[model samples]
Target chain A: MFCRRRNFVVLILFCYNNHRERFEKQLGEVAEVVMKAMELPELFAVFLKIGCLAFGGGYTVIALLQKETVEARGWLDNNELTDIMAISQTLPGIITVNAATMIGYRRQGLVGATLATAASILPTFILILVLTHMAWGFTDNPLVRKAFTGILLGVAALILNTLRKTGKTAVNTYADGLLALFTTVLLLGTGLNVALVILLAGGLGWVKNLYAEKRGAKKHGTD
Target chain B: MALINLFMVFMKIGALGFGGGYAMIPFLEAEAAAHGRVLLENYIKVIAMAQVVPGPFAVDSSAYIGFEAAGIPGALAATFAICLPSFAASVIISKFYAQFKTNTGIKALLDGVKPAVLGLLASAAYIIGVKPLYELSHSLASLTVLKAFLAIACGYFALTQKRVRIGTLAFLTVFALVGILFF
Candidate 1:
């Protein structure tokens, strides 16, 4: 019975991975054909759906956006979505805002982007407000304090998980590796501006990419 | 605590917030310390609310601080201010994206930017993780080690990426319940 139960758990995980793989395959094949043009109300509604329910912060919601736009809605192809992710990360704020702004702008226009931004934050704004009210009394309460600590621990785990996943892909080449190392040191070690660090790092990458551009052509030669 | 000052503080933080939500933790903490506005105990609540809320942690935090400082209007101001830089950036980038989507120069720039983001995540782990995990827990004597270990155990599982987000939240609730019951 234990063996059967364990197998069932494995089966469920397998099915989920398989489902994701299938979605990815389809996304690759058909991403180019359909371009969803959503109106203001429709745009607001879609973002609202994501904003209200999607938790665990910005990076966590990237996958949700991928599912909603690339897989389900076909608002953007996988390539465009990848581009958006990269761009969003490079920009400021959070992944949620950056992603929403890019996606909304791409699908609609200025108004579309504004609507998306508003929709994305409205849930959080209201929610924090509610929690703030509840939070007042909970401070001296030992139970809630202990619970908060526990939750913070869990949050730590989630962040470390994301860091690992992102690091796997982000730190690829020798230059990239060095860049990652340096960035980790600089940001943590010094009071240097984060924005300046980003700008300078991007500058370095640009130079490296330029150096590699010709070599890259020779290596890949297909593009 | 003028609304404008609230907005400006957030705007500056927003500008500096390059890595992501968690990466901005130190900046927020500093602002809290410098201003002496949010008491440490209350700030725990800020962090709590920041974590539990649906948006980015940084954004949620600013809203929390804003509300703490001023009121609903302050919250609105802070929220609006933080969103300003990113929104403007998005608009500018959107305009240029089409013209430069495939441009080698733009691609190269973003390429360099990517790894640094990875670095930020590393720092985020240290900067954000230390406070609640070690600092706060140390104050308690009984079962401090056990509580810390429980957190570590959950964090380890969380790293497995098996439904990470909701999984973390689930584990948090379960651990919280356990904490309530046991410790």
Candidate 2:
């Protein structure tokens, strides 16, 4: 463990040495941001970029933010990004909105949070209006139906791709894999309450942990 | 009364829209159907637009239904209501980020919740796909060779290619337009 810590420190120092100039630039900007009062326009512009470009929603926007904040803006590092994504997933609303609000509030407090939230959803709101109108206007056109059918087909594949990615993160063990499979069957084949399943599965996780802990303790005692 | 009803409907949708984004599509469709203000086919088109358009699908669908029900006020109200729960959640979450991140209990619970949500997401995809990709509206004979080819082609392209959503959307839009000119 001590060697591991030393190696990690060495790795960070090596990385910092490699990017010494960039690191200094980032530190100078960080100090500047800390000294200045947060501006609403800046906040709005940043979030507008995130909101508009996140066409695929969720992770696509998250990836965009990762690029902007980590690579370009130097606001967050890899560890911070992972922590934020983890927290956002636990939140009840759209992960994108949760992420925006969190990032805003972290930087500029309540006002920043408000502006970011507004900026993130504003493009979506306007786009929704335009789409609602287009749907109404094009209802008589059979071509619209055909195009939508094709879009639906594409959406299915897109969703499957997303599922595969999420599954990689969510399924870590045999137990997790079994739970995922069961939940899939329950949802696809039956009209069971999803809320109930979530609660029950969560309970199962706790129970599994407790059982494993007890077994490990027993083995240690025998040893 | 209509405005209040609209608010309540969307609040329910937001509450049940676990996993969020396109996962909410199935829930939004059911709620809109229950309201009986729009046909299923029309609602499907609206969902497709929400998917193709550059924004959050959950809000887009809510706004669509709200506009269908009452107009601008309905649209605004429904969007706000549906977003309220998550906004509230964000406030609490951002404040307690450190504590929540370190909590083993929450971690264990999320272990289960995440996979269950995964199932819901897959279920959403299955429900949406079955009608458009697999089923025949009129009869088995109505499922033409051309329709199957187009569906497979779109699905394969999207599934295989990177960043094909916008390209596929543009392609399908033109495809549909030219299709009518030919037929």
Candidate 3:
């Protein structure tokens, strides 16, 4: 019996040591990922790159990232990508970079986040830097001006398309449609502030929901 | 004094800029007016430039304006200042949201904000659209009517179309080439 008990204690110690070792290894991996991405200049360049190529704003970037990272590289799964997109939209900062960072962090921890963000932004930053330097000299160049005009028209089309798509998803009910129309009128007709409009809309939406809930509860109670 | 002023003004913008970049415009305009460092016309130019450039419109524009105002350091400072409040709020809200994921009140509040946010976005789009369209109409050129019709058609097409592909870029490039060669 004593021998058996001694063996059991040894077994417990062995299990504990093995568990600790695995935990340490996982932590080390996470740390390595985080540290790898902390380089500022390289990461900044990545951001610039993403900015340059990523047309149609937030959604476009999300889809591109998914194709490149999730499908091509197998860095993340669909569900995870969706979750990050949702969270990124809800948060502030550039949504694309935020999503990129979150996905990277999830995949390889910090280093991944940093590298991914840098990779995404680098193109835009460099392009902008070059453009800024040349803008004065090229400001009146007919070809450059024409090119920009065409790009602007394209951008307008893209934005209008996005607004329609976003509206379809966001404006589900009559109340939502009314709210959108009202907001549009208020903003366009008057110089009503955008922040105030959002706050008011958010507040109204909450109140409306609560009122509906209470009414439902009362009806149920009566029944 | 100027740098400190820049910091404070941007901090206010950061705090109040809900519903993302475009939503921050009026606040930015008001602040820019107050500072007088940049003229309203110049501010509008910066916004236009921002829209044409990539990434989040307001943030990138802020950086560009900062660079214009005071160079690289200024750019960094402005960017940091504008993002500070949103970053803090996001981090805090994220923590709170994790704990209260299913709380009805929280959910209701978020639902309430949706309409308002949409309103803000819609308003920005309309405002941006109006200026360009008006300018085009007033130009009295032969192509003015054509451009106006095209713009309206694009808006309608966008509303009806199920999908808008990047192929639009190829069309734009072709149009640009034609404009360069013919017009």
- Put down candidate 3 lDDT per residue, B1-183, tens digits, no spaces: 656767766766666454556655556655555546445444554454454466666566556556666777766667667765655554444446566556667656655555655665555444343444455466535474366347535644754656754454465565456335533
Off by over 4 Å in 2: A1-38, A192-223, B1-9, B12-16, B37-39, B132-183
The lDDT for every candidate, in the order shown, is 0.72, 0.70, 0.59
Question: What range of 10 consecutive residues in model 1 chain A has the weakest lDDT sum?
Answer: A31-40
Task: For model 3, state the Cα shift of residue A11 in Å.
Answer: 26
Worst 10 residues of 2 chain A by lDDT: A193-202
Please report how far candidate 3 places residue B157 from its true position, in Å.
Answer: 1.1
Estimate how well candidate 3 is docked, as a DockQ score. 0.37
DockQ of each: 0.38, 0.39, 0.37
As for lDDT, the candidate ahead, 1 or 3, is 1
* Residue lDDT tens for model 2, B1-183: 999988877776665455667666666666676668445566777766776667577777778778777899988998888887777777776888778767666566555566666776777676565554444554434545355445545654555566644544564455445334432
Fnat, model by model in order, equals: 0.69, 0.53, 0.33
For all predicted structures, in order, the TM-scores are 0.74, 0.76, 0.70
Cα lDDT tens digits, model 2, A1-223, are: 9999999999999999999999999999998886645456777888888878887667677788888778886766878888777777765567777787788887788788888888888888898788677557776677766666656655666676667777888777788788778878877677666556655665676577556656877999999
A best-first ranking of the candidates according to their DockQ comes to: 2, 1, 3
Pairs of colliding residues, candidate 1: none
Each candidate: RMSD: 15.9, 12.3, 7.4
- The alpha-carbon deviation from the true structure for residue B46 of candidate 2, after best TM-score superposition, in angstroms, is 1.6
Give lDDT tens digits, candidate 3, residues A103-215.
55555455655566656554544445455666646645878555544444444455455556566656677887787777777766776655576567667777887787789
